[model samples]
Target: MPNSTLHPLASLPNLGPRTAWFLDEIGVATEADLRRLGAVDAYRRLKFQFGRQISLNALYALAGAIENRDWRSFNEEEKAQLRAKVEG
Candidate 1:
């Protein structure tokens, strides 16, 4: 079992400790904040803070987290849209 006291962000898929830290640094400290920001916006914010050092996988992971699925769950179309939004 996991620690019940873990931050809500830790409960989401693909958001391992380091990725969670990035989100935390950006003030997305909870699942609700993640949702409110959405994957693209959250990726944008993280990118803005961390520069190009952030992984594209993290963006897909955020999309997966919002949908309560694995990052691999995203289809090509969804991934493309997300890429466009972040890269735009």
Candidate 2:
């Protein structure tokens, strides 16, 4: 069971129970929070909080969730762009 008022992160694309838990741990519990933080910032927070426990794929997932698309939908170029944002 889950709370009705708070939008579940798992309800978004590319996010599952474990990922939702991870986002919650990093203070992102809803779509509004994620939207406010944006994918790059959210991924950065996750990386800072979880370090190597988080992966590059989480960045794609966050972007996909924001765009309402699948994580795999991002082409190589887009992935590279995100990689640059993360590593830059």
Question: Each model's C-alpha lDDT?
Answer: 0.86, 0.89
RMSD of 1: 3.7
Q: Model 1, residue 22: displacement in angstroms? A: 0.6
Give a tens-digit lDDT track for model 1, residues 1-88. Answer: 2333466687798887677778888889889999998999999889899987798888999999999899998899988988998888
Winning model by lDDT: 2
In candidate 2, which residue ranges exceed 4 Å CA deviation? 1-7
In candidate 1, position 68 carries an lDDT of 88
Q: Model 1 has how many clashing residue pairs?
A: 0
- Tens-place lDDT per residue, model 2, 1-88, is 2333234888899988778888888899889999999999999999999999899999999999999999999999999999999888
Clashing pairs in model 1, backbone N/Cα/C closer than 3 A: none
Q: Kindly report which residue stretches of model 1 are placed more than 4 angstroms away from their true locations once superposed.
A: 1-5
